[model samples]
Target: MTPEGKALSNIVILGFGFMLMFTAFQTCGNIEQTVIKSLNNFTASGYTSMSIIYGVFSASNLVAPSVVAVVGPQLSMFFSGLLYSAYIAMFIQPRVWSFYTASVLVGFGAAVLWTAQGNVLAINSTDTTIGRNSGIFWALLQFSLFFGNLYIYLAWQGHDHISEKDRQTVFISLTVISLIGCFLFFLIRKPDPSEPTPSETSEAPLHTESTDSASVSGPPRRSLCTQALDAFVKACKLSVTKEMMLLCLPIMYTGLELTFYSGVYGTCIGAMTRFGHNAKGLIGISGILIGVGEILGGGVFGILNNNRLGRNPVVLLGLLIHYLAFYLIFLNIAPDAPQAPEEGTDLQAYMTPNVGVALFCSFLLGLGDSCFNTQLLSIIGFLYKEDSAPAFAVFKFIQSIMAAIAFSYSNVLQLPWQLLLLVVTGFMGTLSFFMAEWGVVAKRRDSDYDSI
Candidate 1:
């Protein structure tokens, strides 16, 4: 392939790999329906078994990054793909143990894919372009998942049609996609030599200082591990300045709100179904709105940040909108429950006030929640140049961890508790206010440093 073709191919392959892995990881979004169906075909223990399966997957994210750091990105992707394939293959058995085991493997593999993709993109793109590239990558992956879920939902149609055999088929197809991704990874050329190696780029400033004659007369040799360790230590020791803290607040708030929305959305769906509402279309519409929101938020934020509008005000405004959306969800829509039947009847009822509230809440949540991460990522790109990948990775990891916990708690808990979880999450938005303020101050410090 020509250089351009090679680059394009790399992006395509990597992007597809990311999409497949993400689909596998996020298939949990369908778990409520899947578990409900599994109970009818299998023994009563199926629900608990499914929970165990999901919980294992959630726990895996905590360790996936550490694994990726030790294993090279290519190996990480390969190993992850292999594990995903194995997991899907095992789904044919439909045993509880098989489900749990498959979930763990899929989770581990997905973490590897996630970390590797970010590293690859960072290596390939410049700072100015990285946010846009990342946004596009994220958006595409999400779009793939949206369609994947739709396909599954349409195929299954009603809960009765989702047999173990059918579930196996679904996973088998996913495995094939993963295998294709793994094969494509081999075709991906190594990072361009013109681009800095991960180690060199991550520790460029230190390496430059060590080599400079004014700083050190001789070639100051240091082990890569030592340099990496020093870089990490420096990153950690760099106390969260008032500016840094302020900058992080908006992101953190959005992160918290995101977790809440994810948790509440599922519960709201169940609630709507219980209240005799057709929520399927509403759910799909919410997904599209979220995609649109992300595109708008990331694209506009990137352009504005690149031009003149500073990151803080834009992010702050997004946060405020997010906060309002959450308030609307909690106060206006989410509190209503299905009214008790006036007369015992065999016939099913139609839409309830609760369902209407849920649909509206979902739309608003999608609008507000979509922009949080995109805006935060763009801001991070604006803040640290060399450290962007690692920093963003760490931030994403934190969000994943928190989101996993929120999901787990939502799954286990009952109604008011779930709502309470969301309410608490809304309060977390307060943190974003400080993060925005911090970013404003940090820009000044950055300017002063540049002047020096």
Candidate 2:
């Protein structure tokens, strides 16, 4: 095939691949949330949360570069889907060992999956299109959130307490969906490395628009050990930059928010019900609202992908949105807010007067989350384009560690302490924006446009 033909083909493959994997990833996330409610026990869910995060988020990051270099992005995603399925399968009978073991596998899988996807997408696109590409990727991925939550909303629509059969039914279907991702991953071909352009080979970190861009094809392959060590060395150097360090603060904050939304927020919703407050059932409606917010936020961000105002305005807006959501969460968390569960199993009671505002708050959280996460990807990919593998590796490593801490301590925090934690993190997230180089990709893109 012609080089241009190959490049166009690779882009289409990547765009579709992004859509498929995240569908499974986000679905599994929603299912986990629902499962926690179904089990109606915080301790098991906590162990699951802590262990899985360590496995999927923390430990895998330690070796992400080597893994991606060895296996390539398509293979990396293939295995990631498997790990996710393993975790989903454990929900059927979540013993301590089973849960923890599955979590580790999922962690490794997630690290590789994310690293590969980011590398492939960023490396293949031009500097001018990175924002748009990442935005599109995020927009596609967030759809899974919508579908997953919609499923939860439908399944738990009228259920009082979720029965064992219900849990089995929901989980079994989620596992099936996750397996489909594995199949989709098999269909993608790695981008060709023969071109002299900046895009990566299957065996190298992405350098499409990087300051330190290099071609992997010109030299003989390095040993995996040497490659891994070199990757780590570069990441360590980038890790020391003020911009990188400052930006990490927000990424870590994102980890905290993830744990809260995934674990604590569900518990809080259950608590709003009259049937023992924190009773076990799906917080489907709330989850749906959050997904809706994410979809809207991502779409808006993608549309404004061409904005010359730089990333600063969007990030600042994200900060404002998340803070507002956090404040509402703090205020309306009272026992009587949702007016308790009705006599039947209908969940409509939880949607009563006081809960509407909190649900809107959830919507805002999703929106804010999209703003920060999408921009963070664009910024990191742009700044460290040549070193994207390590940049993202470091980012994921810190995010996972902070998330692990949050999950470990989540159960012990009462409302007041949780509120305090949110406040601190939100402030840190806001500060992170100022610390980062604002509108870097935008400016670069504008210059590229001028040159053209």
Candidate 3:
């Protein structure tokens, strides 16, 4: 097959595998807080476990580039998939010790999984095709939202609360689904090293220098520990670059907002008594709507935005939409919604809660999330083509740290307070993104002028 065909095939396989895996994981995650809270005596256990997951994920990213470089993306992904499966299977019994232990392990696994994913995707793409490839991958991956949540809604509708028996059955089914996805990783083909890259000519000398140094026979081949430490140091340096520094806020914003829609907002919907006893089931509906919004946004920004509109406009659009969603969430949901159910508290916001409006806000949040993520993926791929693994590791490091912080506070913060934080961060992140874009343009223009 042609190199392009092979590249496209790898992307499709990766997308399908992720869709299946995350469909199961995310479906379980969407209900994790509510379900775990229901089965266990501790109400905050769900939030705390999630916090641990992201915290470990944040630290693990420091070493993820080294792991990816040593094992390669396919094996890294396959092994990480196992960790995710272990985490999901724990829901069957739901012990605090077992659950939290799995959370820590899964956190480490997540760092490797995501970094390897970015590394592989970057390897398979060039500047011209990266956006479209990212879009195709994202669109397929986000479809998990539709299929998984639809099942949850159907299986869970009309239930006031999830039962232990129901939880067991749900998790067992999801575990099987995730395992199938994991096996698909074995089928992926690595990109040929011989394939041409836009930066290949410029980067050849660097590769040659490293190879020559390694071949001197004066020292043993760098051990995995040494390699990992080197990669970790490189990622740290990359994180402090002017371009990466400018992009940090926007990167961190993705983490914060991602935690919101993925876990917190759905919890609020579940806790809302105004939606009736079936409100708990409405989390599935919200997930579905959010999935719809995410799929649409991924298609537009990732696929359609390829060479047309610049990234900054798409990010600004995301910011505006998120602001709208936040306003509606503030008006329609209770101020203390994140902390307690309506039955637990008498508080209400400016307007009475409406299920329709709540779902719409979820949709908007999903759409905006896609805009930010797709653009960020493309931007990183374009700018750091040669250093894709370490660059992506740096991005994930900052993103996961913010996610860890957000999850830590998710249960403690009221709904209004959370919305306020998002609004402020969204503004700052958008402005930073614009600055980064401007810098890239100016740098490129100068390079072009110098060449003439």
Winning model by TM-score:
3
Cα lDDT of model 1 by residue, 161-216, tens digit: 34666666777776676577676666556544465544336634332331232344
lDDT tens per residue, model 2, 273-388: 53333233345556667767777877788557568777777877887887787767766665332222233133332233265776787788788888887788888877777777
Please give the lDDT score for candidate 3: 0.83
* TM-score head-to-head 1 vs 3, winner: 3
Lowest-scoring 10 consecutive residues by lDDT in candidate 1? 337-346
Ranking by lDDT: 3, 2, 1
Q: Is candidate 2 or candidate 3 better by TM-score?
A: 3
Off by over 4 Å in 3: 40-44, 199-226, 341-346
Clashing pairs in 2: 55-107, 56-106, 56-107, 271-277, 274-340, 274-341
Question: Using Cα atoms with residue i matched to residue i, what is each candidate's TM-score against the true structure?
Answer: 0.71, 0.83, 0.93
> What digit string (tens of lDDT, one per residue) describes model 3 on residues 1-452?
88788878988999999999998988888988778657646433777888899999999999898887666677788899999999999989877788899999999999999988887787778878888888888888898888878878888888877787888988998999899999997777655557756633333322222223434532334664575677778788888899899999999999999899999998888888788877777888999989898999988898655654578899999999999999999998887777684343445789988889999999999999999999888888888877777888888889988998998898788888888999999999999999998887788789989999
Among all windows of ten consecutive residues in candidate 2, which has the lowest summed lDDT?
A: 206-215
lDDT, model 1? 0.50
